[model samples]
Target: MATEPSPQRAYRAACPNCGAAVEFRSAASALAVCSYCRSTLLREGEALRRIGQSAELFEDHSPLQLGASGRWQGAAFTLVGRLQLRYAGGSWNEWHALFDTADATGAALRSGWLSEDNGGYVFSFEAPPPEALPPPEALRVGAAQVLGRETWSVASVTTAKLGAAEGELPFVPVLERAYVVAELRNAQDEVASIDYGPASEGRPPRWYVGRGLQLAALGLGGLREDSTRELKGRSVECPSCGAALAVQLATTQSIACHQCHAVVDVSKGVGADLQHYAQDTPGAEGRGGGEPLLPLGRSGALALGAGGTRSWQVVGYVERCTLPEPGDDEQSFWREYLLYNQKAGFAFLVDAEDGWSWVRPLTGAPQLGGSTARWQGDSYRELYRYTGQITYVLGEFYWRLERGQRTVNTDYQGPGGKRLNREQTGEGGDAEVTWSAGAALDADVLLKAFKLDAGQHAALQRDVKPLSSRGIGGLAGLFLFLLFVVIVFSLVRCGRDDCAELRSLYGEASNEYQQCARNTGGARGYGGSYGGFSTGGGGHK
Candidate 1:
């Protein structure tokens, strides 16, 4: 125990202080200033040290992968790519680091310009903001350079379980192949974007372009299809006896039903072609810059450009729903007229306190959902004001979405768009609660609740539900139970034949439920794929 151990063998360029063996993660890996000698060894061959510059190639896929995630505020984003850089003054170098977008905690993913080369392949890269640009290591691409290779072709991988943000995002180890591009540039000032290949193999590539991709990429949901995929939702109708529909505030007075070929009155909803007007705020290129913010609750009356009209608490139009730089590209951020649509089912979250950000086809949500205002998703619970009838119902306190790893409860922004509390639903999987109050449910939230998949857009005529007849059914169940007990009692006290008949009747009733579960249509994806804008869209977005 008292004997001193032999020193470890060092590389050819051994240090004078500690002759210990050393190893680096990547050949071109950036060097950490040596603590023992304060020296930056030039990494050559197996010799670890400082690195030189060369063009780095974007692999077909990123080395970094995403983990489990929920919505952040009103948007949904996942951790997909990461790159880190160290910038001292105006110059910088990259590091072998982690770009954790899993929870969208640090720097955001900005618009990455994309272009295809003559070689039939397209490439993309996100340009970091102009903050003396930190080396790649800061974002966690890892500080390392190709010892000889200038480029890398990122290949296959081993996945760690995904729900880490709720816990610890387990790092997936990667084996990489590198290559050096002949030329490269800090194309931030140039075009920036990325492509999401076809949502369905039957459609064209889906490109989510904007300054912030998190929102631009969350395609719509609830469309179901089969092998011979044909699009639906072009027309809507009344659920009862197929009929053409119309809504009170729609620009279009009528919508026909394709299925039942009937006429349904839509004097209830808004259509895509409806001309929406907002205070003329500036748009791209210094449009609304320096414009005074439309003070909250200061909006005037709105003309729907249709026969029906409604007044709104005009909060000014938002300037940049655009995802921050390193986010999205062309035609993203825009000014929108935020208002409550009785026909459509979304809450009119008048004005976001910060930059302009627009999510498509604005839909309503309960201040929360199926419960108290607290029961709604993060975006619904704290953002909008209640309009319409208030009905008290008992539900739970949980949101359908949230941003951040489910495990590590970090600082998440609040309803006012400020970082506030943690997203932990105290109910573990059982946070069932009971509430009583009048609350307006967003049309969109109701759609999700009632399983009304499609049809009925023009007539924003809210569907109604009558009380269940299950109460009468419950009394019948009690009568049957009492009879069965009496029969069994009499059988044991009297004859064998009586006991046999009771057993036979019980077996026949259990098989009915097993038959109904086979044809139910439902969501197949944790988030399903879209048909892209090409195939008339799966109506996803």
Candidate 2:
């Protein structure tokens, strides 16, 4: 078992700009921001030099704070500093964690980073690249690259800016400066990122590798008390309508005004200029139904097998649709409710025309090849490929969202009711790929989980059942009836290729083909529906 090392003496200095005492816990930390004056200070030997002014962090009301302690891999660590960064979509935080462990020579303490984006978290440590890596502009989503001794798939390539800094940081942050970040993952559930600090600086890209972090298992302490209560108490006046809209989640970057139905941008915090945009209300023409079955703020407990059961509340809702294909005239729409748990982060509850499912963005990328995808030890077969677009949204979201935001989606069906969905957004080097995995949820199970009343359950239940559920007797009777009709049709000289056309058009596995076979006095079979919406962004990749 791993162990935490004994506490060592720390180097103390006075801030050059603020003339306040600043403490450095780790010998490796090169810079520190004065908590009193927000001065960016650089350490040279034993003296501190004022570099620049560190921007104040936007009020995110995050539960994790400086001095918070947690154990990872049996080693204890403390949250010492944070760096807040913003991209085109939204923002995220990388909290510096100074480990209470020593280096190989026992001369210095080690450190890692606790990344918090949207609601997801990952603790990573800096590592040396096996070889020279290409620039961020050369990495494309879904493409494979060799890193170190393993091959990894490019997950996301984002250009972000340093928005703020707080507490103490290992390096000085160029306030409001832009940089490129590229993320990659392997089949072994390892997530890695390459950070190229500001293009103008010409600094070598730094790499960090780690796995998904579960806060419940970390045994973290010293978190902010009543963080949710503080978030609930905060309200901001809508720029478009004068109505007060409450920002429910501490990580909320985008929220829709309840009164005017306009989406508000609070990425820079409510104190900054709040950007608002007009959008049509849900249930409007061509956008499908707007209201969600599980209303926002509704709490429920979900059992995710080995992941255990956790209570979640609906904090955000979105309506998405797949427009008609080249020759198809019908459109398929679905609803997704973003469920939030204080410790477990976020999960999506998707309600499609087929049925219901609960999915969460995966930190590790699954291996994809040809017509199959493999994750962990399970395998999934490709089901549907389509283009999905967000048509409407309600409540709060962690990323900047706009109407008609589109992505290319491919869904896969796995054994034991498991499902996998992959969504790719943006173009070329700017593209981002995200994967979500979950199992099908029965309406009755959800009805019980949410503790909904009879009326709500009745309205929510879907009539999607497999033909095998009808029992042996009912199947036998139906098969005999179909055979008799086929014989009668043959005797009447019905067109021989009448049913063949449908089989070719809709395919044998489709619901349309099964329905057509039943209606035309033929025998095929009906199966439960499969597939889900492709929701990308916000989640930590």
Candidate 3:
């Protein structure tokens, strides 16, 4: 069986600033940061440093194991695996789970248990945008740079994770807990990462592991750390400030100095595709130092439909979305696609730059004036509610991210003869109604429809129960068949008439006579023969 990360060794580190005793977090890595001065201190690589006063401790209040249950938005949710990542002074952890929503008011959803961690948690979908997050603050800033473009009134979201760590970003613990110390390394194979938790002896950090990749750790009272493949090798060292920095391989084009925060355009600085460093250094540090390097790669995650239309959906860059509409001008900026599922009777419009656009009309209740509605907590009549039938299998959702733009053209039509179609040509945020469209509403209002109160979500699932067809008719038919079978068997007995009187004559031996009838064909008289319908016994006649 695969086990978690291995145990980590504790060490004391000098406060690079105050010279007061400090410590290392994990057993690996060369440098250690001073708790008092926060100065970046390097070790002689691959050697143990010193120790200091130990850190604090924290208690885990949750007993939730994998697959635990919880209640949210009036629905029950199943616990998925958790994501835990450690970086900087603290770490972040996130739980990936799924909830089954039966109705809009969220009353039909199940309530699963929840594990709350002060260490850190993902922002609730309902929480207001934070101060530093970029796209969410587009309202205040006239125009912002995102996905390689700048736009006014663009829709954007600040993601807390990058690369593989995107799934779970760990946050620092509010209360103290036991943590591990580790030695970090740079791309050029230098000993860089350092950790300090419980076991500090008042000195500097020294220890090295892994030529490439970053680290993943489980923090308890004691230290535990290990190497990981999640991190890309590209690391940064500031020439001006000498501060070490980690380069996020996913979206970073330039290296930002950790101390000075100077943005370094690596392409201009280095004339090569990747950078290199020496493997040897002094003072127990693994690799001494070398020129910083960064990779010129383009890799980004997919965001499904955030907005759409009657016959289609609008998706693409955050900047292309005009917050509320996709004006005809910005339509070309985002890549588009159309998707259809005949079994579920649904369609999707995917915009590469924005997100996904989904639609499913309800044929069950045919009425006058077919209109699009959204799914909200109280009613399915809201704007997020699509007029349609749906079956979400194995937690798969109606919305998903796609690679490029494609459209589905079908004979199925919507209100006023609108055919099933996906088009990229539309006006800002929501399309302007000038060409026979309508006003685009706010995303928050639509998102609110998804928010479920704990109890309401569970209630909606209870009302609908599964049923089998044919009802009592199936039972009655079975009983009558059995009765008919018994009558036919009795008529085929030995004596055609007055069989009961014959039974009285047989007295206590009647059962024996019946057995004889079954065993030896009963002389073809009072009882029937054993062989059925073959002999000319009265039973057969």
Candidate 4:
């Protein structure tokens, strides 16, 4: 078995290929990449052996680096190594962080992987082997499976190749070799992953469980200062229209041109692999219908958490339509604007006919019970369910999106004008669920935040009023006021003597003619006799 090594003092070895001095910080590390020649070297007692060459690390917008120190959960750790992995869509960094804790034997030190995923970071530690492991073929994305005591839903299953490595690592990693990885999330937003080794290696897959964390929570220092500036200022001309387009982030895969409205694929870098839809002509499919409510490159401050706010820029915009069932002719649609920030990842500003909601993706799946779903201790009632199809897209996105892409959406209503949305793509076990929670915002507030003119877009002029407590209170007050007016009118009419006399006379008329004669006789020219009427009160013939 591979075991940890005891702490060694002042360990240094000279590279055999380039004769460059290589330093080892952890005694357990068996391999190190040469800083000067980029050669992979293995340590054998007192000598260093050259194994292979390391690939060059790509320039990313990440602010983390080796030698940076930070604290996590009251424990301090230092970033000592990194493994850059590339996938079909993009690449990510798995930073090897060495903790202050020691192993069981106290001979070797412990380490973990801090992976950068989708503009967020996840810290994971190796967990104990499960009782029984499932084969790769048996696992599917979005399927609920039991691991240990927690029921987890698979979020993604992807294959990644080792692009590059630096500093030290606990195990030897093959360069350019592809491996399988499965990521799962539970109801509490906690994340777990399984890293399956290359099939040829015959090594058992490893499991890890951890939580998602923000960059600010790490309290890291000595990060690369120019990372943000480089990413923000990066620009390239569109291959289709030749218009200069600015790339939003280093990880952006697709960017749509503002002039020609063509979706450009930037996975191979800017101005490469551009594609456009056949129906991308002017005024087709509501493409050129109206201006966007929130224009691209506009920024606004949003309150994300307690005592903290983040400024996010509107990077991408997409309009999607929800068609009624197969035979129905009615169609409904909404618009979604993608918001991005370096530290906050991505958020969405959703505009529908009902109202506007600021949405952010949830880290975990909410627990569903019958017609209700619970998230963060709050229950949401089912609002509506429908299918959404992509109509148009503009600006940059982290994922590859195309027109006519469809998704099944379920919306739920929560307390305080909040909304919970569940969107699923694909079917059966291969489906993917994306959950988002949002609160309704006024149209004026949204426009003011983005500094947009209300009259520019007709959509912005129409505000969808939500059912709020204050509005309900106003309705209740109006109902009570009308009731009070009816009661006052009845009392005033009763106080008048004329109304009493009329009511008495009407009561008597309701009886037979005898009662009428008794009540109104002698008052008029008629006498009290019912058969014949006397001319006067006496016998005045």
Instruction: Count clashes in each candidate, considering only residues at least 3 apart in sequence or on different chains.
Output: 115, 0, 124, 0
lDDT (tens digit, per residue) of candidate 1 on 409-462: 112223543221111112221121111111222345323322444563322222
Question: Candidate 1: TM-score?
Answer: 0.18
Query: Candidate 3: where are CA atoms >4 Å away?
Result: 1-8, 45-541
By lDDT, is 1 or 4 better? 4
lDDT of 3: 0.25
Q: Write the per-residue lDDT of candidate 3 for residues 11-98, one digit (tens) a residue.
A: 5645545777644323332444344543434554544233322232111122323344444434444443333332221123334333
Candidate 2 segments whose C-alpha is farther than 4 A from its true place: 1-8, 104-106, 281-290, 428-430, 464-541
Worst 10 residues of 4 by lDDT: 532-541
Comparison by lDDT, 3 against 4, better one:
4
Which model is ahead, 2 or 3, in terms of TM-score? Answer: 2
Could you give candidate 4's per-residue lDDT for residues 1-541 as a string of tens digits?
A: 1222334533687888888888776767788888789888888888888888898887666688777878888777778788888766567788988776675667666778888855667788888756466776677765678877777777666677888888877767798888777777778877777888898989788888777777778888768888878877888777777888888586676777777777776655543466545223123222232246687888988774432677889888766656568777445555678887777777777766556677776667777778998888899999777776665677778765555557777888889987777776655433556677778777677766777775754446333223334555787767756754453332211011213344465652344333323322211111110010000000000
TM-score of each: 0.18, 0.84, 0.17, 0.78
Question: Model 4, stretches more than 4 Å misplaced?
Answer: 1-10, 270-289, 305-307, 426-431, 454-541
User: In model 4, what lDDT does residue 51 have?
Assistant: 87
